[model samples]
Target: MSNLFVKDIVVSYSGLPIIDRLNISIPDHKITTIIGPNGCGKSTLLKTIARILKTDRGAVFLDGKAIQQLSTKKVAKRMAILPQSSEVPPGLTIFELVSYGRFPHQRGLGTLKLEDLKQIDWAIQVTGLSELKDRPVVALSGGQRQRVWIAMALAQDTDILILDEPTTYLDLAHQLDILLLLEKLNKEEERTIIMVLHDLNLASRFSHNMIAMKEGSIVAEGPPSKVMTSSTIQKVFDIDANLTICPFSTNPILHSYQLSGCTQDLLENANEG
Candidate 1:
């Protein structure tokens, strides 16, 4: 299987550093989630790993080699990335949209070979989009549209898949649906899944490993039990998280949160006299 990691990577914009010399290794065939409050460089770290944005001072390695040295097509063959949003053409069909993923494997003239077609079909089937394969992209609901995007990634037939905030703009049920699909893919197919999420409860429930960031640095990195504690939550997000274990999921659940900043606490402490 292919391995992916970043070493001492610094990402900056206009001399302002957003991520400073951060190193992270993604375990093979596991779900790794990056979590942090706003502007903590979670997305920057992910973009660096996907090679979409260049790192100022360090390198991203894939299979023991620097990823930048590899051809774009070579990297695409091993990893697929879904950005926060995609612009769909007005009249694009689901099948047509998904077929674009096969471009990396296409030879001259870009004909869909039998293998590519079969892979596309399998992707649709696995994502539960078989019935909607011929539907127009503009007509599907939010959840279905998200599935279509993930289906497109699956068509790449890669060992690693990266998504940025896949649950955005989705309802609680739809969020669960998307995460469950990813869990299934990781467990059954052993695809390395890396994603960014804002929901601590969901991240705790779903991720095999969690990396929490603050001001371009990692506050915690380990299993959910290690990072979901009240102290870690306070350090990473500046909030005191009330944590409890769910009987069904057995993962840490976020019961609630209270602001940690002294300025935000205006209520007077009243002790029973």
Candidate 2:
């Protein structure tokens, strides 16, 4: 188990800061979800942890070692990342796409070794894509395609997995399926799973730790019950909402309402009256 520590990370694009002096630690062997509004730097932070994006200041440490000092292959062997979207190579089958995960382990000629085959098989099995291995990637539905991408990332066989909005473009069932798969991977396989998720309720349900960010800063980080409160939601998302115990699960559930433009003025006038 290796902890991911982002110490005062700062990320910028085109001279504009996106993640500003953010610090967070992702515990090993747990599922951590980052939830925020669009463009809140969730994806940016994930990419920095994965070493896909260079940090402008500070450092990302994996197991107490600076990630930037590690070789690309070594980093790939320790951390696997599934970006929000990936280009689908023309005419590639699911099996072929998943086999690409072996790139980090290849020596010469990029041939798949016995170990690679075993890993690919296990990844496909875990993702339930064994039947679709031969199917062309472009021909599958959005959910099926997303599963294939996840299978590829799993084939990397890393201790840490970072997924950027994996549930995007997935239907309700597929979203649950992916979340459950991640939970199983974390609980049974002892893998650290970190993902950027938009659905707050799903994040609360599936994650062992929740990180709520706003404007490149973390608003709250803790277990869902403590971090998903009405005050935190309002502060992070600027929504007036009611928090209630979920009927079936006993978890905190947020119910928000649309605030009419005149409602505030009317309420203020009534207060004065």
* Best prediction by lDDT: 1
lDDT of 1 by residue, 13-75 (tens): 778999998988899999999999999999989998999989888899999999999999999
Tens digits of lDDT, candidate 2, 113-191:
8999999999999999998899899998888888998999999989899999999998999999998899888989999
lDDT of 2: 0.88
| Candidate 2 clashing pairs, residues 3+ apart or interchain | none
The superposed Cα distance between candidate 2 and the true structure at residue 208, in angstroms, equals: 0.8
lDDT of 2 at 43: 89
